[model samples]
Target: MTHNVAILGASGYTGAELVRLISQHPDIQIAALAAERKAGMEMADVFPHLRHLSLPTLCKIGEIDFSTIDLCFCALPHKTSQEVISALPADLKIVDLSADFRLSDPEEYEKWYGNPHSAVEMQKEAVYGLTEFNREAIANARLVAGTGCNAATGQFVLRPLIAADVIDLDDIILDMKCAVSGAGRALKENLLHAELSEGYNAYALGSTHRHLGEFDEQFSAIAGRPVKVQFTPHLLPVNRGILATTYVKGDAKAIYAALEAAYKDEPFVELLPFGQGPSTHNVRGSNFVHIGVAEDRLEGRAIVIAALDNLTKGSSGQALQNANLMLGLEETAGLMMAPLFP
Candidate 1:
């Protein structure tokens, strides 16, 4: 059986990525594409790379017929998604790719996002869309919230450790390097070629990155207490992927064991051999996550790393993963393509 899905913000990078992946899906079809600012323009024109494929002309969200859509992927921006999703059909199954529904508490959402969540009712029902950690719940959810690319990468390394009690919970540090595309396709002076090329710098320092809200919420839930990691994010000049290097006081053997056991059966997450590490180049343009663990100079300290394409596994691909389970389709369908590498 085939499913017809619509993309609510098809003009952006994530939306175009959804189109590229779904074009090869055996059980899903792109029914409509909406791009408010670019309404009435061809998707191909907006994204020249997609010119060869046939896709709907970008339309405003109001023009979409929600009833015909089996599921809708809302790739709209943070605050914008709340308003749009709040007004969407009540019965429409949705996989939101924005930060709008990711945090369960409206108060917490306001704390991190700087605005009260407008869709409190729907927010309460949304399932966190980390396919590895919350697969069963995602399968039955009508509203699935995709994790932030940075948040998702960090969790991939820490969740298992927290669950297995392999790492020192109170003293964890995450140093992340994210590609510029992770900032989104929106034009910004800092993202320009002249400004960003051959240069790298840290932005959200001193544990001020917004994704930390997710870390606090999820880690705390797992450990049954408040768990906050020292997190600092840097902007890399590269065009794709996120690599999170996490420091923890734990037995290297145990850290590797916990991670290995957790992702042993996960199709998209790969655990590198002990002492080996992963690079962003290995996971570009794919939903795969490569994790590695190594011992620090200090005997009890360990370093855990995780890497994935910020745009693919980090956002659009993750949205599709949840959308698959929500529709009762195989969780891995439409997402098994190999990573692009030089």
Candidate 2:
């Protein structure tokens, strides 16, 4: 029952991560690796940390026979994924880690991503890959769109609250800090060691972060109305993990109760005790998400926090989780490794 898998963008961080985790999977095998710019090179050359493992050489997407791939993880960048996936075999099950198919509406996709979606038909059929909330749909889906790391982290804290009506939808706010690797492995001047080493700063301020589109769409759907949260994202000096501190107007105990009840059966999401907060260090390099709840001194306000590795649980790990469901494999298989900590 081994599923032959192809990784479309295997040269990047998320793709390499998929290799790392899938390597440990008993029921999944890496059948092909595609990296357009680094074609013909060894994956080990592109990622020295993966040198010890026997892996396929990187090739252009078209060189591989998609007909043999049972499932493909499309880790290509935003717009790039749609084009590549649109041409892929129709029957090929896919877990897309890019932002391409995450938003359902093509108009909304254009609004956030600045371009009309190239694969409108496929986008319509794509299931949102928030593993915990969309388990049933993911199990039956041929194409699953992985959420943005930031979007996923924030929703882990707010979705249950919104669903239970325990929190005021109109006043929700999210302050998130993410490690640089969440930006992707692409080279940028700002991500260089000299520029990003010492201090942290915020970007996409004033409600401009693109992941807000996912928040607006998902929260509104849950509450049956337009729900927009004040979201501001910052880049941390660290290498991995994300911590989202959410402010909501609700009874503290009720918020915790709703979250606990919603995720009581979820394997990867862990809820911390009341008044205790989670740190990114606790979830680094793991597929686990830790959520914490606390009350503000003011009576009607409460705080909810969620933490996870931006690269693992946030992207590649999430893709792997969905792939498991689509293939009828154990959802937690190959993903039960403990978190890496100092």
Candidate 3:
């Protein structure tokens, strides 16, 4: 009953996370690990935290024996993800944790990513990998496109309200704070400990963040009309979670009721008790998403807050969730670990 899987980009943050998580899967096994630049290195050398587990030595994608892999998780960056995925075996089941195939339109992909898609035909079959919302599609999909971490956090807050028509869609505003890990494990001057510690700043203001494309595409599709929200993302000094504070002009009780109904039966998403809000501290290192709704003193306004480990529920955990469905395995396998708390 075990499925063998391969992980591309095994040296990156998300890739290592996939390894850490899949190591515990009851029905899955990591048969191959690929990290183009770090090929031939032991995964233990690339990520010491995972040294306890016996894992395959990293190799290039071309070196993987696709015939033995039942599923593949690509944790590569945007453009590279598509290029590699396009060249992968057509029959390989892929869960891509990249922005490449999330957008359904090739033109929209070009607009946000600034280049023509290398695999336009592939987009037609890719399912957006927000597990809670796209479970059915993901179960049948060969290629599942994992959402942007910020996009996943925001949707956790807004998707229910939009679908239930409990909020003023045009006036929605999302102020999110994401930890540094969501930027990936790349070295950059801005991400230096000295440059980011004890300080925080906002980027991609004015709805310019690329994740906005996800918001537009998903929200608009749900409403059957154009629904654009004001989204602003901030970089926090911390290393692992995402907190999204959403402002919506709607009855607080109604918003709460809608969210409650939406996630009541869901395993990974928790809707807090009425008038209570969540903190990123509670959901760190777990696949769970904690969401809360508080009534603003001003009538017709409600504040909805959501939190999760950007590395877990935001990316790798989500990819694994979709992989479970795609493989016809239990959806929550290997993902119910309790959040790490100080």
- Reference-based lDDT, each prediction: 0.93, 0.95, 0.94
Question: Which candidate leads in lDDT?
Answer: 2
Tens-place lDDT digits, model 1, residues 219-299: 999999999999989999998999999999999999999998999999999999999999999999999999999999998
Question: What's model 3's lDDT at 116?
Answer: 94
What is the alpha-carbon lDDT for the whole of candidate 3?
A: 0.94
| Runs of candidate 3 exceeding 4 Å displacement | none
lDDT of 1: 0.93
Candidate 1 TM-score to native: 0.99
Total backbone collisions, model 2: 0
Q: What is the TM-score of each candidate against the true structure?
A: 0.99, 0.99, 0.99
Ranking according to lDDT, highest score first: 2, 3, 1
